[model samples]
Target: MAEDGRERLGIVAGGGGLPMIVANAAIEKGMEPVFARFSDGMTNDSIIGRSRAFAWGRTGDAIEWLKAEGVQKLVFCGTISSRPDFRSILPSFKTLKRLPRALRIVKGGDDRLLRNLSRYLESEGFDLLPVQAVAPELLAPEGVLTARTPTAEESAALDLAHRAATALGVLDAGQAVIASNERIIAMEGIEGTRAMMRRVAEYRAARKIGRGERLALVKAVKPGQDRRFDLPSIGVQTIDEAEAAGITAIGVSAGESLILGFDDVIDRANTAGLAVCGLGGEQGTAR
Candidate 1:
């Protein structure tokens, strides 16, 4: 438990409900949470009640505010889909020193970038904590969670999709795949899982698919991905998207992926006749 005066959790939130979940979990643990989100990343209505707003290039100011608030621990959550406008990123004298390194950071791939940012944050005296540090229950558990279970065919397809997704993770490409009858149908790209599922939905609508075969929506954690930032996370919307895409089963990396709104997600999946299962694997990559 944190002390009354000198301890607080600074939540650097992004787009999604996961940040709210994390904040609530921290609050339950007796830590005051300062919910801060980027100006462009607060697309979720859940962040509306109480929050601290910060601009993209104002890390120096944000850090000072958190320090003043006694927020010694920091947790980064949510999806930052928008690229920083370099023009707006003008650096002050204090932030000017970090700007060059930050610019170089953007040159690397996602994993490299996350690692660099984590290190930078630690160097600045803030303790970077994993999301699970505050919310262990958010981690997806092993085995099926819904009333429906994957059929024998969908089981095999899940295996195939998991393998393909892992291979793709090796290239830092994507974390999710859609498969049927042991054949890969679609893979998540930069457009993300929802968009990929929508594509599958369009295909199903156009061709009248699902010939008694289950569509498997498989999501895996990226191989060697920094858990502090991009651990694979799913919410209730994922279930609705999968069901709309004709997905009969959903498999995520057990113990590694974050299952936001787990109970509600499972309840909706069961009601929609979709199976939500967790698959085990190593290095956060589901097998």
Candidate 2:
């Protein structure tokens, strides 16, 4: 807590706009935001003043810095594009004791890895908060968001994509899938959503299909996923990628996925004539 009685929030930032978005929201809510920036992660420059940089393997250093900053609540946002190189680990005495467990966590599948990592962090005496807990405005709302509601065929495709995405998530595999012409063409893997979309684009192009063909991109939270972190997210860039990949519609689990720049995402999808909707309980309202 600060002298003003506001909690100091620690953001473990990686690549993308999300860390900055969370920081801005924390500030608005009267929290002091401190950053633990990964050296290889693409942290935005705007928050540099309050950030301390640490390498992926320097767990001890990062935690020590956050503690020194008086942060008790930590939230993780953005993407860690690749796994850390265990060979490069530089452990201090404090973390060295837990090094073996950390290695095993890294060896597990994505969901199991995150669940264990959350426990590991909690063991370090800090409370973990999910992104939506700090910034509920970022959560995607239910119902169609764009001017173009999905066609009946496109809606059916969206349902197929969602089912495919859930299957991928159940395996701790990935969160997004592209279904085209009633068939699953791609399921995100370690390559991620952007790469998967690019692959879809290339596949379509190879078959001599032009832009704006029929397809849907759907993302969902893994069944029994730890909601404390790593919720699947989409943004304006998602719309751009979908358009590029010839996807005509996009669906995400309502209140279960983040839609960064929500209005902009809707506007972009509308302008592109793509259908965007959230699939789940009809309880959320558009922000």
Candidate 3:
């Protein structure tokens, strides 16, 4: 709690800008933001307010740090570039006590891992908050957000991409898929959406094709995913990457995905003459 007695939110920072964005948003809503950084070394030191860094296996330490900071609500945000090296994890007494459950988390896919992690944290007494709950305004509303609405072909491509994303989600593989010429060309993996975009760009350049109106990328939440962690998110960076990948339009699950820096994302998409739409339907519905 703050000196003013307001609750403080503990943000588990990862590799992207979303963590900071969430932290700032929490502050605007009168909640103090405390950070818990991981040993992956991806989270930068540009964070505001109090923070503590811990190794992947040091769950007990992290919980202690959050408790000390008076954080009762916690949210996980941003991208994780790599998985932890289990061999390198220095076992603390706390970690060893929870080894079996921790193993279950690390051994699963991204969605499973996060779901288990959220459950574990909540079991330990912290209120796990989802990104949408933390910042409702950041949720992408259903509509065309760009200066130009998607062309019929682009919209069709988006539909195809959405289906592909759903399958990807069901597999607990990833949240994004790129579609062009009525087919999915790529799906996001552990490397993340930006890396998948780069791969699409490479494929297009290599083939010297598919750089037209039918290309679209759709990002959506995995079916039955725990909303408290690893929600699909996009920002101005997503716009820039999609543009670079020769993607004609972008579709995101409405209310299920987070749009970091919403205005900046729209402006970037408009400037690039790219269509950005928040898709709504069975797949895009919020949990």
Candidate 4:
């Protein structure tokens, strides 16, 4: 229990470093942190040492555990790689009874599932907090994040791709769009940004050896999205993927996209001669 009379903060960690970051942030803020994490997805098991943690299969059980620990507020973090196989989600009878409504609300996307999950947790007496509220520093800063500036041709491509990505986002499609030489290479679907980047790389690699012209990757939040869940995120891994794929520039919404491992990502981008920029209010090219 916290001195402020608030119950301990409970975290549902899915995968990657994001969950660990959230847990650490909560502790720094003087809140007791408890985590319910998926077994094979979390990046570091050490996170369990920092807070109370349990595996995914026992989520319903974990909720009870949090209540026992006096946790009243909950935050969910990390990516649960979308799966077609539904067998993995062994919902308890409590959750199972609401499966139909959950399915109706989710409609097969990360954002929808999280929204439904948040609603369910709130109904169970746990107040769900926005993941960003834990660590607002993870949000990307405005302006360029690389040493190299975009070329005039690259700028044109970026503008086109940004608009396309923003439009797709509005439609509840994925957040990333890859474009090169004025042609759209790929639009992110359920496969995610990394998968989309790999596909673009494969296509580009098949065409030529070293043309030097690189694809532009743009990611942004949907026009009217709830900020709590499914906020756009990029990290060191994202930069590595773009650099490996010979992408010249990456654009992300300034306040909307969370830049995990910010310093390392910038260092990698600079070393690779990749231009990383945060889009401000107006959608325009950043060099």
Candidate 5:
């Protein structure tokens, strides 16, 4: 992505361990990592040393700062709770210059807006790197990841959940769902996956749906999902939430989702007696 030596990569941080993981990987490979934290997204206390926090609405400010810092490439990572509060960001001169396009972007869906941002940054001479390039180790692999495999019934439930998640993803609705006996019980909304799982737990208790292999949670990449931001991710917390939700199995599209602390996620799933499988492969490649 570099045309010269000015190739320091910036991690456009949101919230989560992802930015840290990517930052470490970039550092290990001897790439300079500038953390450009988003105010609307999650940030860890550990970020103070290397990060410059910015607002999501201050796109121009972020870009101008990156350019000044000699960052020629950027990998957008982590999550924002939702859209930025546009009313709060005082537009920089640069942002005002692109106000029309920026306004259009703010009016679009999240994926569309992110893709537009990537294009806008690239058009401004900065390279946009996919998360995979920075942290291939986090990519989910094909087949079962945990020791436990899906029971026959759960496998069927998995397929159902997968299809449901796919349809939801196509609409850019959300990434995950909790399904039981072929019925969709919960979908990740603005509340997110963990909260959705907790809601499922409440439902099971109220509906008298006893814990067993009767439920499965599935995560799928959106059709033509933008790789720059909001990639589906699972972790030890995911396992814990699933267990709490009476979910006995989990499925994610292979290569499309990330397993943070990959080993720990699998180990936790195994310990919880939950099946975690990465599904989908096309032409012998993880997809």
Candidate 6:
């Protein structure tokens, strides 16, 4: 707690355990976390126990709630589905007027929207903190995660996929992309990574025979992305889905992407004989 009353931390939570993780981390740091959640696209009630939780509709209402709670700092975390249908935002009059302009500026993707939102919040006197500022351990470490390193061909495929995915991210498109044999099999769009991978697997199955070999999945962050929200994240479930989809290698940004389950995810990748690498720069050599 700081001199300004109780030091309150604001969390704009979406779906998944990431929000809970952020709340717990804040608690450990001795700051009170106040969660502002959306009714349709947020975590379960269990998160309430970890922090001061409130349900809000419009973005204006959310900001008001945070201001009312005396939150001086803000953190945005978790999986907010990229698809428009998954979001049930009820912007207030002020937010509604600014919404279109912000959407047009950022193209309405997770990273862009959140960055603009952070700027808006800052203009209103709230300081938005980096998501990693509270959960540093979530950042993916540089190295080969699995026991087996990527083969030469798989490494090449990963390199290509990484560049493509990063470019897509810059366009506010998506975070993950699937590539094999120097061809883009699938690019993540409004649907999440798992859905894209599942679609790619279905397509491969339809092709039959020689086409079913292991594919490379690359997840990267946009070069200038704001780290407060929609940072690329993977976990044990991500590894399980990759293995089930017959993915051979998973490449993520060395320091930018987050690995939620960290050890468990790496263990599963190693057990499944899959290659996981945190890649950086133009060079794609396995770490």
Winning candidate number (TM-score): 3
Error of 3 at 208 (Å): 5.7
Q: Which residue pairs of candidate 4 clash?
A: none
Pitting candidate 2 against candidate 6, the one with the higher lDDT is 2
Q: Runs in model 2 with CA error above 4 Å? A: 3-5, 90-94, 208-213, 281-287
Arranged by TM-score with the best first, the candidates are 3, 2, 5, 1, 4, 6
Residues 49-144, candidate 6: write the lDDT tens digits. Answer: 424343332555667767777788988877765333314555557557566654554456666666667777788798888778988988887878
User: Considering only N, C-alpha and C atoms within 3 Å, which residue pairs clash in candidate 2?
Assistant: none
Q: Cα RMSD (Å) between model 1 and the true structure?
A: 2.7
Better of 2 and 4 by lDDT: 2
Clashes counted in candidate 3 amount to: 0
Poorest stretch of ten by lDDT in candidate 3 = 278-287
Error of 2 at 286 (Å): 14
lDDT of each: 0.80, 0.83, 0.83, 0.75, 0.79, 0.76
Q: Per the 3 Å backbone cut-off, how many clashing residue pairs does candidate 5 have?
A: 1
Steric overlap count per candidate: 0, 0, 0, 0, 1, 0
Residue 189, model 3: lDDT of 80
Candidate 4 lDDT tens digits, 1-287 = 85566447878776678887887788788777777666554545767643545433344566677777788888877776744234566667644665566555556455666676677778889887787788988887888877877777777778778888888977878888988756787898888888888887787779742476658888888776667777788888998898777788888888888998888989988888888888775856665
Q: How accurate is candidate 3 locally (lDDT)?
A: 0.83
Q: Candidate 5: worst 10 consecutive residues by lDDT?
A: 278-287
Poorest lDDT segment (10 consecutive residues) of candidate 2: 278-287
For 1-287, candidate 3 gives per-residue lDDT tens digits of 88888779999999888888888889889898899998668897687777888998788888888988888999888777788776789899888888888888777898778878878888989998887787889888987887898877787888888988888788988888998746778887877888889988898889745445368889988887887777788898888888888997898888888888888899888999988988886643211
